[model samples]
Target: MQARDTTALHTAAATQSPEPGKKRDTGVRGTGTQIALARSETPAEGTRHLTGSRILCADLPRTMARFTTGTLSENRAMLIATEVQDLGQEHRGWADEQLTLNPEDFAGESRKALGDRVRALVQEIEPVTALERIDDARSRRFLRLIPTGNMTMRLIGQNPAEHGVLMHQVLSDLADSKTAAGKGQGRTREQIRADEFCGLVTGEQNISPRVEIELVMTDRILFQAEAEPAYLQGYGTIPAAMARQLVRGRDMELKLMRWIRRTGALDLDPRPDLRDPGLPEPGAAH
Candidate 1:
């Protein structure tokens, strides 16, 4: 199958077991083995190329078929295949099923669309496990203040995706209002937003709008420990752990949604209480 990294592909093929009496190429390193072969090369670069092919052939065989058939580009095939490599076996299977069932949807799509579609389909490899991982990752969130040479300071913020979107929307709204009021204003939206941000931060403007965030989660995920990610409004989907954090200590009302198995429609759960007598306790014996 074709691969994003030709060097790695040839390397892996060269390393395959040789026919009887024919010795494997031990004297020469495979293209995939470049990092190990050369002292100057970084391991990460080699790993990316090497793992790309392995992921395609082993984890996403159907994608490999498409690659060999010239239906998918090497980069796109590698992109889709490697994305599921982090998922658990069950989640990987789900992703594979989606790809197989809807081949037409992925054909000739842009790289970003392909990535977003894959993320939408897979949700999380293992939501509970992924939640734990996101907790660990949260520690890395930060804000940096850098002073540029031109007497200006740059503010770099690294926040949760939902919060970032909220801030952007607020600033964009202020900027839009300012621009609309001024008839021949030539300032771009980006410039207006920057000025509005300065106005808010410097106490020139006192606008405190309550940020509204919407979360969509399955009942199984909310109370039964289902391995499904949560969808955050205005920010697409996020890990369930992040969703939990977003709602923690906040005054909010819960709305239950029931999935009609027959029609595949999501409707409001009429039952106020979430408890089900027929369902066994998590660890209870069948």
Candidate 2:
């Protein structure tokens, strides 16, 4: 909820301090939290860097582009450069399963499972990010993209490498893949990948099995305040609660913005001088 620009988040990487037989996080977890999971370097036994706890942010320049066009906030496009981070606890269970598979087999199955899982993650991400913009206490009852409160697509025999490759591709697809919304046509899984790999060299970097991701968040945004939609570098817009969860934090810095006339109340019903108090507020009596 703090209004400060989160652009710094894009370049922020989790850092680790080597502890003999253990590890220490530099700032990835910040002063009071544990963000070291992703930025960890195995210092020694009983200690290792945790990888993958994250919050994908929007690329800053692209966000400003939207702002200049004045279309950024419209259609909730502020999220164009944004995406979600933080895999759910459910992902932990599944991810652990991937580690169980043999290297090659594990790679393939894990990658596919990852593809499907990451895809589903994006679906959940969009609504969460969208909800962050909704602080209108006037309507507590609103339709939001909530998790069915259940996880989907749990398959066995999936390999880690499979997940790595598949997750990268599928995540790539959702990053830039467009939807018809009202057009009725949707991209098939194959179609999605075809479009995603268009610019890639398909070598080790493009098709590498292991990759890394960084996550950052605020009470008001699911990902960064801005990002690159073309590269589909990050996920997509997310909600505040989701953002906090992604950042591996237990709370958020909630800041709300509002408007009032010097005389008394707002003369214009829908004024732009608005603030998001970070929670649903009671609306005027109907």
Candidate 3:
């Protein structure tokens, strides 16, 4: 569908006339096709999808045939497409033939295995292009935080394999030390490593004196031991008991501000301000 849309847009643009000194204006550039397809959210995501679609439609007939026949998955097809993109048309077609020659060979292959095979083939076919692709990949390394439910977040990143291995080793060593010292009792090595990573990044174990973490909840949840959950800003909903534990564990000082009512909903300011004495400080003794 995306390929068809792209081709139709290109044909339509080719027939249109340009202004005096300007190029013909076509909306199907960059993420325009992605938006038209409504398949991806970001431009990078859209471009990746479109690139895969174009490569399969225009360059890899055998692979496309497998994809159409449900023998190959879209993800694996896209992986192959992306791997062969830097090759010349003739070489790209050769790669397509080499990869898809044996349909039965892909039956139980994992995506990682398929990707590694494609990469190895690309290296054997053209070493210079393979090196260039490696450099390009290195230049595009990034880290992003994705919020998961239950007041947790997922940290996703890409880095050189060496650096990643070294970082993992360091975290493992720290976790082991904590385990030996009986500091992280009852926690798994993975959990301790995660805690150590957070401590190292946030300086919570060393330099951080007092960090402000926000937890918003209703008056009943905060004071009356209600069952309602509290919202931890930047994370997600956490149990009322967990929220109270955070305040009590951190020895946080709480000051109650004015209760603003809007549209029959009460808004409580969770931020602590020393000057605001509208209500007495709530005891964190729950």
Against the correct fold, how does model 3 do in TM-score? 0.57
Q: Cα deviation in Å at residue 62, candidate 1?
A: 0.9
lDDT score, candidate 1: 0.62
lDDT of 3 at 169: 61
Poorest stretch of ten by lDDT in candidate 1: 254-263
Question: Which has the greatest TM-score?
Answer: 1
Clash number for each model: 0, 36, 0
Alpha-carbon local distance difference test for all models? 0.62, 0.33, 0.66
- Candidate 1 contains a number of clashing pairs equal to 0
TM-score of every model? 0.64, 0.17, 0.57
Clashing pairs in 3: none
Better of 2 and 3 by lDDT: 3
lDDT of 3: 0.66
Give the lDDT ranking, best first.
3, 1, 2
- Model 1, 237: alpha-carbon shift in Å? 2.3
lDDT of 3 at 43: 69
- In terms of lDDT, the best-performing candidate is 3
